[model samples]
Target: MTDVAFDAHDGIGAGGTADVRRRMRDELRQWAILAVGSLAIAGVFAFMLAVSRLPGIERVLPWPTGFFAKGLVIHVVFSLVVWFLTTFALLASIATLNATEEGPRLASLGATGAHLVALAFPFLLAPAFFNDSVASLNNYVPVIVHRSYYLGLLLFGLGIALPAVRLLANVGARRLQDFGHLALAMSAGAVIYIIALTCIALALSLSWGSEPGRTFHEHLFWGGGHVLQFLYALLMLTGWFVLLRSSLGETSFDADVFRLAIVLLAAFTLPAVFFYKVFEPFSPLQTEAFRRLQFVVALPSLIIAVGGLSGVLAARRRGPLPWHDPGFLALVLSPIVFGAGGIMGLMITGSDTRTPAHYHGTIAGVNLALMGLFLVHCLPALGRSVPPSRTVRAQILLFGFGQLVACLGLFWAGGYGAPRKMPAGAAHLVDGAVIGMYLHGVGALFAVIGGVLFVSTVARALLRQQPAAPGINSAAGSLTQIKGRRGGR
Candidate 1:
């Protein structure tokens, strides 16, 4: 049952494990299709918001000027909330499929559809924003609370929850070693996220009458949003570990320590949930409680990250690294970006430009890690050839550079007291502020390019090939064969 034991016996060629790999591979391809579409929308909106900051661009914009806020809200909702959650949800579903041969195929498909529905809403109902519809810029889940938004949200919530439930149920049903510890840990994180969603729903329902205006929605989002950070941190940490394993051929961290870290992350939430329910819904005490809890919840990720880094260093001492592998490049770069985000976070002093800088940095790092995993593992498993090593390396570097410049600009602007999320024209006033804003706008433009590269890479890989030749039960098989022939450890 321990992770070490599972790893020792686990091999792609192992007969029992092969079945799981096939199912997981099939599910991942399906999820990848959904992910690509979601990511494209997210990229476009991200590019738009960046372009909006530049002079001469707003006049040529297709939508009305008021649409800026609406567009920002849409971008935040789909890019930040939907896209990330959908990707993590798919990861958990794949883990479940690995655990159980007879996975919840129908429900998994439904979850994908629901996520697509949520993704589609911003485009489909964008006009609603112009027609007297509200755009509540809640911290985490910003969107209009109209019927269409509500319906999409409801389905999205269900989409996230159903797969989690199936995964957790399977985890309980199976033996410990049967489902690898990493998979189980991932599943546990999914459960925590679903519970956080439930808490948000409860808060929204209870506060509608008691609290008015943004307070109601803020109260609704506060605790759940706080908890979701832990979820994101956990998933990002998992992605880091996965990337390390894929790129380095082995991870340096102790399996027991990693699993325990995951357990502690899940355990810490018990108090968070209790604190939310026991305290008044909209009290400052509640807000402070969740804020402090986020700080506490984030500790494990740091520990794991350090452990992973140590492992990488030790591996490098053994031999020269496979620098040509894009996955390897990402594994090295992502943590640096994430750490920059953390440092930017520590510089917060009553909400300046640093706030967005912190988040975008961290989120970009997470995306990079996940993208690396896809290129190294998912594409190969799905019987798709990874792009040229040079191309993949270029994409990774472009993303990292873009994000670094963007965050640097924001931090520089924040130091000058430039307010965060100001209108596009506001930052253009002071010369120093203009430089900062221009840096962000230009960097974001490149970040969008990097994102586009990812989408294009995935599309090319998939489109170039058929749905894997028959007799290949899982995508893992293809990867196993390739690695085997290469004689890699």
Candidate 2:
């Protein structure tokens, strides 16, 4: 692995004949990401926000599915595509910082291209055109989409190819001896997630309509929900990098531990190997066996969370570290919250109480971690230092905590047979159910406030800034200097 540095301007290369291809690849990657994001946002505006699950089909889809499709397309797109793109770019930045690793560089480029295709075609078009392409049982867009949708998915898959290369190509942060471990584990886990989902997608296509494919139909999308929970967890693992970096500076993460966790994440795929047909009203043997496998898939993941969190906390230098700021505090709280959710899942029996508790915990924590870290990157450009922002971020922290509590309440309510994603809010609650939902709603409001403030800060930063230097260069510098001096108060 040769050292690399981030040169967003010059083009990506070490100044050889390869430089032309490298620059083209690198610049193309950058341009592709921007282009896809632009189009995706437009498509989302045109298609999403209101028309999510297409009403009357409410009973046909899952509780979460309707809301996720309609209201949360933004979150889904950002979570699956934007988050990775940002992370990929960040990795490229790190690779650039390191001054080497053609694979990561290429991965970055490919992801950019993939994102563009995903945005324009499947994501944009499928929702726009396909009535048959339903938001299906597995909480993802199913085989209801048309051929164009498949192409979009294929393009996204192609984009994923780069990350796969990085996992094997071995190039990232030079400071860490095991730079590639986390990347490899995440790649494998993501692959499993995609494959499982793809199988479900394919099964959906073949099983529905005039003829159904029963064997494959029963196998896919049944336990796939739990597997997706693992995917969320897998992503949250990246937060460990921030955890590792901030706490002891750098501990050189345990590669074996990370890999084991990836395996734990993928453990659910093993059940697919047995390939049994299942449906409601199964015989006692099948029900019991299926239940056992479900629990089995969860246990190791539970262990992985425990191990990962414990490793991070114990790995800490043992001094009182910054936890008051929303960003850093969110980092501290993510795994803890996610672990709590996982624990809830471990202690239940299809009662619906524990699983989404774990789901919300893990997913919310992952969101907070990702958003919080990105804020860390983008916030500093505005003028506030990480330490200082922590001091002023009280409202932000309170908002997040409020949201967590509310979500937790919703989880408990769901366990006791309360529904999620209701437009009715507390009105839908019956008897004591209202208590949990009301709490959840109130918490949501605060979470919204915190989120708003975070965005506000970013917006403020991106606005034109007074230059740090003055007229040593030109009249532009003089104007900047004058503006800075005038605003110095």
Candidate 3:
């Protein structure tokens, strides 16, 4: 006699799915906490390098950019490396909780290791001219190519591309649908940008004998730089989609429109962002073409943003929206800040203020949203449940608002003659504006406090071995199914 046993429906159950997702969320919290620490260090370095003078920062630095650019390059070396690590941890943690994609995860892990090594190249190249005698330009200024830096860039580019290839392939040819397509576009765009950067770096290393390697490198760099910026922006949008669906439990407004926007971003955006690379480096004629492309990069983002905002409002169809949920808070803050960034981008051509305005807004605002979403979205899954109370509610409010304002103030100040790192002296600003310095410092301070508190809370939850609330289970999962890792995915 065979005993009849009930199945939990294709190996999934309400509790099991919940259990899996919750565990994944917990891992996100820890991953974010580690990221915060690295970002904080970068921040500290930024304030110090920006506010104070450094040792022999001139003769050795081969670039001629702004203080912010210089400081930021340092920050990127530190921050990107950390981000690479943080990204891997996130992948591992995600795998631990999901346990559904072992082969891809392993490939991603290997690719990440290569990526980290690639990230080290910039660091190796910096000491050549980071001294006071080397150079003093803005942050994001292109450095003259160093051999180590070029090689490092090659490694870095390969690292990013290889993982992307594996992950895209792993999702398999059959699974390419709505989300997969978005991911593919994003990855492809990223590849383009990465290639552009490598070309720029290569150009840097070459001698410009009456020409900068026939201008291909410059155009490539432009393409790469713009695309890098786009990659971040695109990922943030995806993050928004994730927050909305998972956190808010609602379908996005005009989902097809958003997807189309992504496609347009890939198509129209490429030529616009990379036009500079196609020109004569010093030809006066090419200026207009370059400027026009800048407009291209900024316009579509602004247009799409308007559509997204309208769609969001349409979806809500009312005011007095919930301000307490972390996910909602991100939706509130991210788009608004990015919209403001779009406005800044529209204001001028090649002005220092105009250039960095959008950059700061996009980078800082997107990061802001990502952080807030992780809070409300992932904490409970990790067993460190945030109590729904006036305090947490207030934390959510002050945290998001304070950060938005702080990032804006900082970026605006940077745009408004608040030069980047070690600004000769605040007293010697573009118009001798004392107010600029004060505003920048204040903004940085506020942002720091907000970031610290945010991380502390997540860290507390991450350290907890048991669920924060009573009804949670602590079952373990595989980190990688192919290995002896605890939670195999």
Candidate 4:
């Protein structure tokens, strides 16, 4: 059990004292509970998705089709939206500790409670309410229109927003230039996302009487959903930069470039808010305007991505890298899938299978980066060491390849005009296009398996307590070296 010295420049460095380390460990471990819990549930829903799509598999199960649909919506909202937000909050809480040496204990606990409630809500009520209550399968924020669901969302949003606002305001109060650009960017993005959701909730309340059911939910979440994409992109890029820097063993990219990227991402997101708030809150015009703006939101990520790759290459020229590093391998594979997603996106015309192809690849890319960061950084921070396992090394590849195959199948079927979200075993063209559907199904199954494995590995790592490495964890390493040099002199 050794201590890893915290570097001030790393943006998340807390004090190297044992007590501070213990506190940080406790905070991260609590966060891990929520993260692992959400992910595990996410994995279950993912597996169920396969069953729901695999024709006979779903019917033999105890649940009905509507139940699966309802659960799927709940799963998506919690897994994709809530899980990411909570993780961002965890990051923010850490940065807050590093920057100010104070923990957002109340905020973190409140958010954890909210997440648990949200995660448990559908399971508790879905079976009984599936037929009576409508599952508004909106693009985002899909939840059954139950009072309990709404309450859970309210609690969740407030839980995240309050702390995020505190963090952003705290950072702004201090000299912003002193903090790492990625941390600042992530905090700002979190705040903006919460604010955007708040405004959307308000707008939805106002327009609730006019539109009904899923239509209202659609209008409610459309503008906010578009804005959320920016938040996701920011976090994804933040993960990319952090993991890339860690893999290279240096924070090689310029802080200013990272700052500018964050600034540009924030700047691009503002237009959507203006369009929604100042012009019209819930309208097709607002949706269209925001939709168009979503195109360039990834500009910041692209800039940083290219810059990061260049920096890594430059660093490689200086010395040989640990090519077998699992984290580095995950980082290397991320952008490839992301690029595949982007390319697949260009082929999307109207409602077709390619839509899922584009998103699955893109989302999988982000998930991969986050997973790498968790394994290489978060676990270490939590006083847990990643076990050296070949299966651990292969998780990312399996997931990435699964996504690639799935997307390719989607693109193939889409080329033949197969519609998106079509039920399994439904009527389809009796041609080569059918093979594409088969590939889609098969790929989806593998993706689920990979996803389960990834989740299981993370859970295992988190649960298995390990002593931190001495040279890796202790501030004494550098101090002793300095003392040794002085004694030599």
Candidate 5:
């Protein structure tokens, strides 16, 4: 493998003239604000969710019959669906920053899409307040079985899909390799997202039953939902690169190896469309195929993670680590959390708290990476640097630690046969399970605090008006300066 010199300005394929870069940076900032705002809004619903789950608190709160379920649906859509997709749009915008012909046009479209998502967001939450709303806590993208809720979801999907399609069309195949690993990963993730949308469309047309309830929605989102996980995983991996680059001053893995991992991740997703062709949408075989696909596709991530660990160790031997840097903390914690989730996934024997445990761990891992990326890399690159603060570092640690403890608590309670998505009072848990639930509740409280700190800190930085300095055009340039300063000290 050859060593490719890192170009600070063009890193992640952000090649453009000064004016174009400025315009792209402005657009990227909006996407960043949109992404962070989505998480902030999600936090509101998350608090209600945690309150409805804790033991004694549930008895005191006057949640309606379907409130918890409805809130869960909204929380997942905003935090998981909206947050992840909006961040992807930001990244895709970076990759296409150099497309002089389509860049301006796409920028307009992307901004419009971002606004559309924001407009549709309230509708997703509106159903939870209505007494007539029905929550279908389906596997992937859960839904409220109302026309308004459905309309909100449809508009949200369209908002993401429009820019994603434009991104895919703009990224030429011949230029893929030149875009570097991060850009390639972002582009590949776009492809996977588009494919997931396609799978959902096919599932809608080919679904076996006419029932308009949970089972129907479950199968409706099953295949596409499974596929969407790959996109999330890919995005998490892309974030790992950004976090690593910011923390270590360079990527730990070989450039070609990084590219290969991205290609394989995207290439594997192409065959997922065929599963719909071979097996019925509701078939056990189809479900199993999607389940197995996750395991199979995870190999690339395993390779990257192993390589990253080795790199981190080598860097550690050379000098002191960046313990003060939140990016470093996030990079270190992400894999630990994600790997734990993967192990817990293997331990699943039934539909218990273990399922939520697995997902929470994995999702938190991804969230941590994106959080760090946004604060430490994206903000600084766009000329909005979050000043060095204990609050930022504390936020990362608190969230990571809280999530880990929460996952452990859930796993422990699951061992005692505690049901998922039920309040402690309603779960009919054993004494042992109750203890674990208490732990879970406490951990979630701390995690929410940490998440709140992150949101406020980033929100403040985003709100500030900062003049563009030299090298603000390149994401890697800001990271490079951080690395140089750390090395000099």
Candidate 6:
């Protein structure tokens, strides 16, 4: 089977024409730009974070007292929250392209929302420079405790949420029939995203007290943050499907089984709202309930990942693997990194660097999947082809291995009692901890280089004006030719 044939069977390209596909690509362009741009901006903050953590760099470059904490808060919001959600919006937009009646309205609303997010993003950074702004380094969506920062966060959430609502409202049996399992997966993710937002609202309403310090903000974001993990998990699964299909020409798993897993993942989130009602928002019970809710993601993730691995193995049986293909490389590495993270999560014994190590592994897995999707499925679908190149391949491998090394380094340091979120100079490390930090620093450097390569490549592709290549403008034909050339070899 070819990608074109698989897409037709899967309903993504069932009735899409060149003109229709072009419009769809145009609609997705803004969200893609927003997603990439968020990473670029996040990289800036990430660099600051690395600098702040340097052993003696802080004294040399005198920043404000709370600058490290504030920078971290901004980094988490942009790198994790904004980047992930904007990409989700883009995926949601792709799923709804077949909605003839509702498509146009939704596209307009989504584009407008993307613009709103871009406009509001700067506000998130503005507070980092101000002395008065307090950094609430909460898990999930961290915030700076200032009105300006709050406004920016609110607008950013609203921008994504508005289109999400429209996307959910437009979903129906017809759309499902036309769009197939991919649409179902995206819709499931959107539903979970909305549920996450609702969890945040419920937490705020239930705990409107005069609590002070990090405790309040931590409890505020705890429930919502845990729920948001399901959203990211769902999206990662979706990426796996796209990557497997585009690379292998077919998925190894049964369609019915995949749909069942997705439904289960989404259905489990429905009961999360009651956690707020049943227990006090700030109580340990409520926090534990939300924490346990994350376990639900495990089974489904394993099911899909195992199925994906099965597909890769089956492909290997037929012929040599497409190591040269960036999608194939990412598909192979994503699970290894994520599974390592899951293992590390089980090893976490205290509030040490192990927790960051665990999350870094898992989030890197998600990042790898999305990057592969963009390089293969997304760019081609948008009539912007990304031919397999050494640089692109290196970017994928460098980011994957760099993150893995970084996570392992963190895990090693945490095992030696290195504290989380502390600058190296402040950690007062010796012996093993120092060695681990050294490895962590080196891995992070390589990862940053990889990230820069990705941003530059994608930005150049998005900005360059060129006519659509033959067979590229039609959604069904987008990856057919490219996959044929690469996979046939």
Best by TM-score: 6
**Could you arrange the candidates by TM-score from highest to lowest?**
6, 5, 1, 4, 3, 2
Q: How accurate is candidate 6 locally (lDDT)?
A: 0.77
Query: What does candidate 2's lDDT look like per residue over 281-371, in tens digits?
Result: 2245543554455455445555545655665566455665555445556666666665666666666566443455655665566666655
Q: Residue-wise lDDT of candidate 1 within 6-103, one digit each (tens)?
A: 12222222343445445545556666666666777666776676676677775776555466666777777766677677677666665654444343
Error of 5 at 222 (Å): 0.6
| Model 4 lDDT, residue 282, Cα | 60
lDDT of 2 at 292: 59
**lDDT per residue as tens, model 6, 5-93:** 21223223234465554555566788889999989988988888777777788779887669889988887887888889999888777
| Stretches of candidate 5 exceeding 4 Å from the true structure | 1-23, 50-65, 98-105, 467-476, 479-489
Measured against the true structure, the TM-scores of the candidates, in listed sequence, are 0.86, 0.62, 0.66, 0.85, 0.89, 0.90
User: What TM-score does prediction 6 earn?
Assistant: 0.90
Q: What's the true lDDT of residue 107 in model 6?
A: 49
Candidate 3 deviant stretches above 4 angstroms: 1-37, 50-72, 76-102, 105-155, 172-220, 269-278, 281-291, 297-320, 349-355, 376-432, 455-489
* Model 2 spans with C-alpha error above 4 angstroms: 1-112, 115-118, 121-154, 165-179, 190-228, 251-256, 263-318, 324-327, 347-357, 376-399, 420-422, 425-428, 454-489
Query: Which of candidates 2 and 4 is the stronger one according to lDDT?
Result: 4
Worst 10 residues of 6 by lDDT: 480-489
Candidate 4: tens digits of C-alpha lDDT, residues 1-489? 111212243223234455555554565566666666677877677667666666566457666537666777767875687677777766666555544443333434534544554565455345423556557778767867666667667666666665566566556655655654434766668666875786587667768677458878887777788788778777777777666655664445655676678778877776665675566666666667877887896689789888888988897888976556667767777888877888888778888888888887888787777777677666665546576477777777777777778888888888888887656656566465688888877887777777778778878877774555332233223111111111111
What TM-score would candidate 3 get against the native?
A: 0.66
lDDT of 4 at 73: 73
lDDT of 2 at 336: 64
Clashing pairs in model 5?
Answer: none
lDDT of 1 at 126: 60
> Candidate 5, 166: how far from true, in Å?
2.5
Question: Relative to the unseen true structure, what is the C-alpha lDDT of residue 297 in candidate 2, on a scale of 0 to 100?
Answer: 44
- After superposition, which runs of candidate 4 have C-alpha atoms over 4 Å from their true positions? 1-24, 52-65, 102-129, 277-281, 315-321, 465-489
